[model samples]
Target: MAKSNKKTKKADEDMSKKKAEESKVKVEAEISNDTADTEENSAKTSEVSVESLKSEIDQLNDKFLRLNAEYQNYRKRVEKEKNDIFKYGSEKLFVEMLPIMDNFERALSASEQENIESKVLDGIKMIKKSLDELFDRNGVKKIEAMGMPFDPIKHHAVMTVESEDENNDHVIEVFQDGYALNDKVIRPSMVKVSH
Candidate 1:
């Protein structure tokens, strides 16, 4: 009976040892699985952070380029405006001097029949020539209205005359010659149109 009891006790001890070995294997497997999961999660998080940073950098670069372009455009626009102001600043003064120039031309033309001395006539002619040269140099040109088709854009009709001719609707006479500066009309020609 004692031997049987000892044998049973030894069998029980062996079974317990096998159970402990199986439990240890299961615990090790769980630890390994947990470590792999942790490593995968850490890698995913790192990749996301890197992508987010790259996107932010790209957006900032785009903004910087746009701002630089805007600044360049603004600088160009200001420079162009400044040049224009400097070039055309005397436009109003030139326009105001046109009537005086026309009066001088009329006075010289009327004095052609006077019994003036030859020297005085020559001096007047020289002055008229100088005035004309000055006007030419300053880009001042006369608007030719005589015998040309009347255009409201360049001529102002102050009176109308009756005529049977087809071309009569155009300018019959120019009362006051117009002037232009640099191809732009400074004053419209005062004229008479025929109907």
Candidate 2:
């Protein structure tokens, strides 16, 4: 009976040892699985963050390019306006002098009709010639109105005249001469349009 009891105790000890080893193996397997899951999650999170950062960078780059292009256009527009201001700076002064030029022409015409002295007329002609040269040098040009098609841009019709000889909507006579500085019209010609 004593020998049988020893054998049974040894078998029970062996079975307990086997159970402890299986428990240890199961715990180790669970720890390894948790570590793998943590690693995979971290990798996925890092990839997502990287993708989000890339998108943000792309958006910022696009905005910068747009702002740069807009600034360049604004600079070009300002430069053009500055050049125009310098080119047409004396526009107002030239416009004011137009009436004086017209009066000089009228005075000469009246003097000629009155049979003014030849020496006096010659002096007047010299003054008129100098004025014309000055205006020419400043890029001032007279707008042709009479015997031309009526242009609303260069001519202002003060009266409509009935005419069978001239074409319809044609300028018959100019009451006042128009002048231009470069491509800009300083004043439109006052004229009679034939219908």
Candidate 3:
């Protein structure tokens, strides 16, 4: 009977040992799973933060480039405007002097018929020639208006007259000659239009 009791006790001890080893294995497996989950979560969070930072940087870069381009375009436009202002700055003064030029031409024409002295006429001609050269050098040009079609932009109608000629609504005579500077009209021709 004593020997039989010893055998039963030994079987009970072996069973208890087997149960403890199984519990340890289960605990180890759970710990490993928990650690893996923590590492995966940390990696996912880092990836999200990195992606967010990259998106923000790209957006900022795009905005900077756009502003730089816009500012460059603005500067170019302002420079062109300034150049045009400089180029046409003298237009107003030249327009004011056109009437004096017309009077000079009239004076020369009258002198031609007045039987003026040779030396005086020569002096007037030289002055007129100098005036013409000045105009030519300054890009000032006379508008061709006489006997042509009347234009509202380049010609002002001072009088409308009846005509027997074939040209209708045309400039019959120029009362005042027009002038242009650099292809831009400084003054419109004062003219009589034929009906």
- Model 1: how far residue 62 lies from native, Å: 3.8
Query: CA lDDT, every prediction?
Result: 0.85, 0.92, 0.89
lDDT of 3 at 104: 84
TM accuracy, model 3: 0.69
Q: Score residue 159 of candidate 1 by CA lDDT.
A: 96
Better of 1 and 2 by lDDT: 2
Error of 1 at 129 (Å): 1.8
Root-mean-square deviation of Cα positions for candidate 3 versus the true structure, in angstroms: 4.7
In model 1, how large is the Cα lDDT of residue 173?
A: 91
Candidate with maximal lDDT: 2
Summarize candidate 1's per-residue lDDT along 23-57 as a digit string, tens digits.
99989988889889988989998899999999999
What TM-score, over all chains together, does every model reach?
A: 0.63, 0.81, 0.69
The digit string of per-residue lDDT tens for model 2 on 25-134 reads 99999999999998999999999999999999999999999999999999999999998888888898988898889988998999989988788788888888998999
lDDT of 1 at 70: 100
RMSD of each: 5.0, 3.3, 4.7
